[model samples]
Target: MESSKSASDEGTETASKVEVKQDEFSYLEREFTSELFKLEINNLGIFGIGDFKKMLKSLEIDAAKVKTPHKRDCAFICLKSKEALDEAIKKLTGYVWKGKTLSVKIARPNADPYIKRKNEEQQEDSNKKVKRTVESQTVPLAHLTYDQQLEEKDKEMRKVLTAFGNNLRKLNPSFKLRKDEIPCEFEKIKPSPKIDDYRNKSEFAIGRNSNNEIVVGFRVGSYSDGSVEVGEIAKLPHIPSKVKEAVLKFQDFVRQSKFLPFNPEFNSGHFRQLMVRYSEFSKEIMLVPGMYSNNLTEDDVTELKQSLKDFYSDGEGNLVDVDSLYYQHLGKRETGEMFNPVDHLCGKTHITDVIHGLSFRVSPLAFFQVNTAGAEVLYQSIIDLSEPKENTTVLDICCGTGTIGLCFAKYCKNVVGVEIIPDAIEDAKFNAEQNKINNCKFHVGNSDDYIQSMVKEVVYGTLKKEDLDLVAILDPPRSGLHKKSISAVRSALDLKKIIYVACNPKAAERNWLDLCKPESKTYKGDPFRPKKAIAVDMFPHTSHTELVMLLER
Candidate 1:
């Protein structure tokens, strides 16, 4: 009986250990969120490699490669087999692998049983080291008053302004930049008044309060042609006048100081504004009224009541209230998960000379340039390279708000735009009608669908080309060309030139290969091949870069 009891206790202990091991940690130990994982995966697949087929396509990498190995939780999964890892990668990349042989090298963090060995050696080294005979006292540089700092900053700003102005003017005689043209951590710079749209807006400024040490604000705008305009500067009446004056002086000082010679390493916000002041400035600018305001109207109240009543009072009944209906409609317009209205007012778009001559409003979902000047450069590049003329009938695929097609419409005899987003198509139609551009027409449907049906019909002669030469411009989503889109474009036998504007190089690269591949048929002539490529810095800060690849048959 004693021996049987001992055996039972041993079995229980073993089971408990196994359970602890299984529950303690996750199989996939990745630190990044699944959303970010998907983004990185999608970004990588955007740029396809031509040399490799689907199997090798899985090896493509993106900016996510910078992630630390330690952050990879999946590494700890103890995958059932190497095949499992390959399968996961294949699914993530949207590729297939039919290779026969697979080889993997395993790296061990610690090979030998040498625990505490380094600790013993470190102890011996600590004993050998002794304290120095003398210790030096810490000392800070001369303390500066607010006035002194402001004066010094102004002097520096003037010097930098002179240099920048000279260099810019030398490059282009028409070049000019305003105070707001340059931005910093404290305040933002905007288009100067010299530009017609921003002439009335005020200059932007930021500084700290003297008494309680809070941030103050001002607005500034600048034009590329070197015009600066100041807008109505508002300050909360609660702060002291002295602090207000100090803050204003500091802003000017900072602006002027920017022009002066300074090391990038030594540059920091602390030298000008207090850290707390900077934080307050950021909060003031970034915090939206939508986050805190509860300004509900009577109509909103009525709608809320009606909605509740309809939801609970009846199995199926409708309540009709005009005010409630209006409020509901407004609410739907203002907010939704899939569509963001805020982005329409302020979003990333490249506005170039190609678009400057044309008038249009970008759709909330459509892609455009955030920097108007930079966009001019990009558009001009496209125009110069594309050479869209009177004889050409340009087909702008994924046209968005018809910016590209409309721009070419004036020069080309006719322009046909196809886009996926209905709102975008509406905006494009409105833009064309508003601009009195009768030559361009926009259609609302998925570009892939439009190409498959409409383009196929046109190529087959059921629909008319109306012109001899076809010049195509495709600015697709980050995913590049869909299979259907590729087939449709290729079928356009009349198409002589294709301009592919890709925001993501990886995805576009893949689509480019698909177009040039032998499997792609020629409806009118030979296969399409890349003629030349140009890189544009549409997004300056991040790893992202835009590519324009010209393809000719």
Candidate 2:
């Protein structure tokens, strides 16, 4: 009987051990599938792993691991917990790091490797399906008929605009969007008159083509794939023929020389990128050649510059007009200062473009609308929406080159423009002077700083708020206005109207939500209600549309 009892006890102990093991397994599964969260970071350009970690540290986020899949300009970060992941996204999403605005979103559960290799197999299958579809439609883009291309473009625009409208309504439930005023529903997208070769600016990447030939074009997929397609400019409908010719010639010159294309994986090559900007109105062209020059000596750079000058000189190979030329040296650093001194290789230092009867001088690094003609239509839409009074003070935020603010100078009593880039402010002043407009002032500072200062001046009686009607015009970057700037606008009780223009509707919706919130710690004044919104199809073919929202207290 004692022997029987001993055997029974041993069996019970074994079962207890198995139960504990099962409980531990279940806990780990729950931890991974529910407690942890994954985030995908988009538009992460040239940001190294160290920089990404620093960003998370700044936001007080503890990430489990960060992965760069296929060496793309994106990062997948696994956080310790879902709450921490949410906090990191709240602070870092739409944050501009190194001139690239980041878009962060919650990644799928399959993004985690804890689920074994099933997710990887599924992803491979999906990619194969997509590749097959693309291969089936391998016909050259140029062969497509104009009407067919327009139809495809129109369909894409309609889908994107519809999504924008939906996002706006979802974000601001109390604010009513005038259905009749929505441009996408009421007015047809204004197709680009010059559909073929309409782009004024094109930036090309230097790499080895699929045939392993030295080429200057765009990458076919992620950088890790190491596959590039040469002569894409020649096939693309949006690139100008002249620009294509210049790029082809430059590629030939590079092939003849000993310089190598920049290898992003190894970060060891010389040539990097090329930018071409042309103005059809002024008939002027600007060429900027970017190179990784930390390893290159002074003599090598000088020889390269001379080679460029000889190639574009008035003698043998006058590929393009060669109006302006600049060589930019890109250093090996992860910062906003991407370019070194601008070495003027030949011709003028700047180019000019006429917009709405105003001749604006555009520097190599300055920001200008890619579609100059379409910009006129967009600016007119802003004006029509705002309808600035004669005795109004227009505050232009993120005023690049002061074009929008200067446009309002003629109608308003005073125009004050604020831009973060000092060079852009100088350009704005120069533009104002060139146009013989003296009622405008451009300040080099953050929009929020300048707005708060102006508000303080009015409160202290240095500036009279009652003398002029206040109208704010915001043309922020694709990331939209900063939270502080939005708060400053709300605090300015005297401001009567705000015209917010945005290229990315998603980012704009976030700002609009903050503006329309009933009560917030940042904003003290009454919430500004969305009065009207209109979509402008500034980009015809692509899935992008400019939106202008008018708000009032």
Clashes of 2: 0
**Reference-based lDDT, each prediction:** 0.43, 0.70
* lDDT string, candidate 2, 370-431, tens digits: 77877887788778878877777788888888888888888888888888877678888999
Off by over 4 Å in 2: 1-188, 191-193, 224-231, 314-317, 333-341, 455-467
Q: What TM-score does prediction 2 earn? A: 0.70
Q: Give the 10-residue window scoring lowest on summed lDDT in candidate 2.
A: 18-27
Q: Candidate 1's residue-wise lDDT over 1-553, tens digit each?
A: 1132343344334324422212111212422222222222222222223322333344532221222133321221122344544554554443432322222223222211121232233446666844221011000111344234334433433343344334433433332434323211111111111121111111122322222122224212222211111222232322223333433443443333311111111121212111111011111111000100022345543443344334323412122110110111112233234442321111122111224666555432454543344455556667766887676667789888787777777677777888867777888888888788998878987777676454443456424456466678888889887766887777666676899887776556566655655532333235566565555544322234455667887
lDDT of 2: 0.70
Question: Could you tell me how far off, in angstroms, the CA of residue 492 lies in candidate 2 after the best superposition?
Answer: 2.8
Taking all chains together, each candidate's TM-score versus the true structure is 0.41, 0.70
